[model samples]
Target: MTPRNLLAAGLFCGLAVACANPQAELAAHEHYETTGGSMKLALIPPAEQDDDGRYLNLDPEGSHGSIATRLGFFGRRILTPFRAGAGAAEHTTEAQVSIEAADSVQWVGHSTLLVSMHGLHFLTDPIWSNTPSPTPPFGPSRFVPPGLALQDLPYIDFILVSHNHYDHLDVPTLKKLAKQFPDTPFVVPKDNAALLNKHGVNNTIELNWGEQTQIGNLTISCLPAQHWSKRGIGDTRQALWSSWSVTSPNKRFYFGGDSAYFSGYKLIGDALGPFDLVALPIGAYSPRDMMQGSHMNPEEAIKAALDLRATRVLPIHYGTFDLSDEPLDEPLARFETALQTMTNNLSALILKIGERHAF
Candidate 1:
């Protein structure tokens, strides 16, 4: 098939799927349904989930335009937009970070983040790829390189994967990490084991929504997110998607792997929250109508932080990749405006790429 046709929305589809009655789909997939149009899909053996032929969300939405129309609009835009000092790395430190640090966060560009608390290190949706797609020379290109190279990383105890999107779950980067860490644990969502297995990853743990696992002093909780997943054609929702909570005796951290505005933040906070820091996405939200179902805008992100009762907020998933119509710096500008409207005592740590935010 031509590349344009290949750009079809895996999650958003034509009337055959997208237009299916939400109530009917929700009714059919009752087990996955939860409050506020979110899902808690069972992350079982890949075969079990695939055996059903497809995964369904309780309340789903697709953009009004077809795949071709959206593709053409995006194609006209260059790989990276014109932004002054778009990818400057002046403040980055390549110093080997230790898990023993009391608390620190290293933004490795885009949504890739390395966080440390009470001497344990965890990374979220780590990606070091030049492009956010399987097809190279197409798709969104990176505006900046990763803050720390794979080799520069300190000993990583756990890797937290949110979903299987190319940007969030780059297989090429995963292969390098698996080779380097060998036994480091990879905690992924369901339906993604086969890919990691093929990549020679031996220590992979898959979890469903609401499940929790312990690694050292960290309590890793797999939680629900308002998002969809599809790495390729015919695989929409074949894998589960999630956000995560990493809690230590001294502090709690929440990484919003990828999500739009939804009530789940409050639910997550209620279950296990009042976090020290929240790493939430505030980019790729232009043409808001097209991205609303899957991505959060700056204002919504602030509201989510409030809902979660996070004391300190770190804005991520912006300024690294030109994924939408918004300017490279627009997310930050909007974040400032949104923060002012909020009536709460909080802090926004808008770090430059490769900069460290100490706790």
Candidate 2:
């Protein structure tokens, strides 16, 4: 099927599922009752027009024209069935395997990182799928294949999930990892535990903003993010979204799962200041009028880095999928330009799909 038709069908199917599943409705209500705060059921908001005479306050426009426009530009350059050949493998570095006092951080592509510090191993937003869609057959497929397969990862002690977006919280990848490492613990936002639990991920814990949990010596705090969550149309705001602050003895890492520019950054910085490293999103922002409230542009990301007081920033959420209108390399180029002004304060790092950085 054409990309347009596929998107249309997917939207239709998603809406259908959202409407038919009474369990989902009940689950959403129960979730809200359990954790009372500003609640959003799905990531995308209901279609609405802003005072600026544009459709800025709405869920993503999941239409044939929208899909075709993005695909027509990006489809030719990005690969499908995303298999990294020998050349891609040749660049892969053998990350320090020991879970203790390791010096390296491996990029498994997208937001997934294999981080080893203070004698522990952790995976963040692990997406091993060709596409970030709800279904494997269609959606925004990866532009570059994953550097390492699921089986290739070291024994992961903890899996950190930021939210329930398909790209960040993939069911298939989580299921495979669960089977491979049954004892691995999953740390996610409070409302999102059900997503993991539904997949038989029993060893999971949910936390609210400022709530911290420990696995071994690693202490992970669920921090607030100015973002939304939803897997399908009707289920909007059913889950909570967050960024994570992971602290080890020797190093501290801030993983910005996905967020827009918001005042929360200052709060995070005040609470967990002087982060050693930060992983922040720098992509999927287009037509700023529409995306600015949810996704951050490169300049905004740089500001977030500054606010977080991170020593170094690693840019993720780009170079992996064609999720927005900007060119594949636009984010990095813009980030580079933005860094020029800050001189000493702003430094950014891009992890070549499978590349590893020793921190």
Candidate 3:
């Protein structure tokens, strides 16, 4: 189906497939909701629970994983090579990343990127643990190390965390960063301040969609994305999910933390257009029926980039961990295929896990 068709179908099915949430359950937090009570959801008017325009509507009746599917994903992981070695070979060093420009980006690993703009160094969804899970060294092992070690970073002015997911918001890393950079600000979604505080990480600023804050010379606006937030049970949807637009004096940039394909991209672009560069996720989309709601495949990522009117793109969220059944390289392969089919020449900057690009 065309992207538009898929979106329409999604709205139809997604609206019908409602997740349950009693008012009492969300009494404490007005910003939280959930669909089918699985992944917590938030409603943004004009793009709220009813706004089907660009929402990814996975079928309510689609094939959801049973015990068998869970086992199957595990089996596939064990059997598939998933480019574990090639990703390991791409490890970048701090020396290589020191070649800086006024604006530059380095793909540290999955969903973790170092964006240097406005004369300030910022990291998006920073995670340097050996895995995406809380119990690092015990969960998915990290074959690819970060391009720049925590110590290697020149100095982080602030950190932008998309959600509370382990991959995106590693509290251990946060604690370390907080201890090391005592003055660095940690920007996150609402209701997430306590989480950081628990790790002894202070200076956190929480934002809701449409809220903007000034950090140094740049203006950072917290925008919505089609996604959910949770570190464990009962905390789902308590914290908001978001995309961010960081506008500097001369350049505007975007960081798509983690999300499924949604119309918010167009809305974001409409509201904040012509991004000099956008860091978008492009992996973990196998079993589309299940992941469609929160994860975007390569094609979907491509569409998202176009929707955001992004001038250049850096694809992340793959090659770090084998989160899904698809091969690690499959996203790029599919991205190539989808890009070829596009009539408009799109400038997608594909970087090695540890590589750097100056914009």
Candidate 4:
């Protein structure tokens, strides 16, 4: 095989083997009831796994595009050169972040948000890396730096990580957080704690779908998301993926780690929603055949917000990193367009990187 063909073959092998993880010992599907009151509204079902113990989406068929199609997508990415700094520059704010601010959320760039609510602080899918690639310097570069510098972060009560994808589950950033805040709990999906522990994040709380855990006065629930996870070679679907619902005495918030459009949103809404604010992904969705299974476009994100019965929508996961074929500004434009068509009272809480909005 020629060098290009050889590269493609190697990648194909890697993707093929990225199916089952031998380290995973997933339990049989069952409902878990926690002392935490987050489950008071609904009983979430256990996430399903295949015979190989690999996690499966509620609608597994066609969730991940075919292997051949994936290969073609990668081939195009490899052959088509991206100009350095092709996208518009990101606007950032350097305002002082108050640690005691209550009921506020700040966008820290793609999937990362610093949230302060009900007397506690929370962070979601915290990635500060310049690139999402495991092997850096060769992948899509981050056009924007982290909205809030690490040094400016407040004392976090807990951190929620959605999955093992490099972008969402950034180990380097996690390690930094772990080192800085050794006592903070890092909540992650089943089969993902071991990886964090191996990397020195000792205080990890593993939750399967349907499980709820309590921290202070807050109740955190592991909710369903239509997504898959793969961080290392041969580990696809080895670890579960999830969105999160954090509930307090006066308000509730939903942080969608990453997901494609699915009916689960309505279920979640009917159960523990009409949320005060729902943060949903609205980027990295293009080449529908390649992304439709995992990433939701801006319009789908709008639909998801409505399905969740969100009082307000916080659009995230866009304009920070180059993860798809769409223009950097497209997601927001489409999101705004979709917003114009909304006849309901649901409002959008659009934040520039580093910008904050009160809930």
Model 3 has a clash total of 3
**What TM-score, computed on C-alpha atoms, does each candidate reach?**
0.81, 0.76, 0.79, 0.87
Error of 3 at 248 (Å): 0.5
The ten-residue window of minimal lDDT in model 3 covers 18-27
lDDT of each: 0.70, 0.68, 0.68, 0.78
Prediction 2 global C-alpha lDDT: 0.68
Q: Which has the greatest lDDT?
A: 4
280 Cα displacement, candidate 2 (Å):
0.5
**What does the lDDT read for residue 193 in candidate 4?**
95
Q: Please say which candidate is ahead in TM-score: 1 or 4.
A: 4
What's model 3's TM-score? 0.79
Candidate 2 regions with alpha-carbon error over 4 angstroms:
2-101
What digit string (tens of lDDT, one per residue) describes model 4 on residues 257-281?
A: 8888898899899888789999999
Q: Per-prediction RMSD in angstroms?
A: 8.8, 8.9, 11.3, 6.1
TM-score leader: 4
Candidate 1 runs further than 4 Å off: 1-53, 57-69, 77-99
